[model samples]
Target: MLIKPVQDMLLHNADHYLIPADIVAVVQADNNLYHAFLVLTKIKYSKIPVLDNDGHFEGLISLPLITEQMLGFDHLNTEILMHMHVSDVMETHVKTVQAVSDVEATLHLMINDPFVPVVDADGIFQGIITRREFMKSFNFLTHEIGKQYDMIEKDFSSSEKTN
Candidate 1:
């Protein structure tokens, strides 16, 4: 089997890198900020996807987004967090990539963005590709390439000695 270098491997599609939607933490658009806050607090992730009742991608919600709504003149207004919908404060202008998006394009985006949401043709959420996961995969592949090079070098040296 042949393995391509990182430069060549990046040309592949992004589907293999996805962390599927079924395992990703998500919030409903209709949920209140308080509810969103609870989930965000529980999960170690910085942000989560917001879905509509029908499982369509809506936006992204984070602690800051939810907390901003709770701010008041003198105190944190519990009312806003408990009453306002998540759709009100969640980030709608999120950067997203399709399952078949180019890995190189996705890599460029991940440089600044922490995670890129994955959506289908109809805007249905599929999964997310996080920077951490990408980095880990990159590291593993590079190491594998190094191993392959070492093996090739050993083979070349042994063959030269036999001549």
Candidate 2:
């Protein structure tokens, strides 16, 4: 459940390097959602990042958002794209998980969060935790340490049952 071990796992993965940093970039407030979409189109297979003016974690400008907007665009004039700012559409009340947070907490955060923004203690943006990363981490955790998941899951279920 430690972050150091999880970070090490991330680093140890052979395909981790293939995962580009820009795959989880934070977008600035000045950036338009349209521009964001354009950037996404350029890196369609990668994760999207959204950041604040000070390079803090804002929220994710995800593929789902783009797909939703694109699908709904038929109802609006095409020019509506040009006037759309990220602030106008981005989730302002973003849920952030600290970089030092334990892996278990991060998993819970990711489970409930629309998109979990990973940040440092100062709230500066680090990277993001996608469902993919969660899955990958889970694979690593369970595979490397058998029965760890069973114990963790049992504890979690007990807590829920008690609550």
**Number of the predicted model whose lDDT against the real structure is largest:** 1
Error of 1 at 89 (Å): 0.9
Model 2 TM-score, all chains together? 0.61
lDDT, candidate 1, at 110:
94
Error of 1 at 37 (Å): 0.7
Candidate 1 residue-wise lDDT at 21: 92
lDDT of 1 by residue, 29-128 (tens): 9998888988998986668999999889999988888777778889988777878989888889887888634576678779988888889888999988
In candidate 2, position 125 carries an lDDT of 77
Residue 4 lDDT, candidate 2, scale 0-100: 56
Regions more than 4 Å wrong, model 1: 1-4, 7-16, 146-163
TM-score for all models, in order of appearance: 0.78, 0.61
Cα deviation in Å at residue 140, candidate 1? 2.4
Candidate 2: stretches off by over 4 Å: 1-23, 45-47, 63-76, 112-115, 146-163
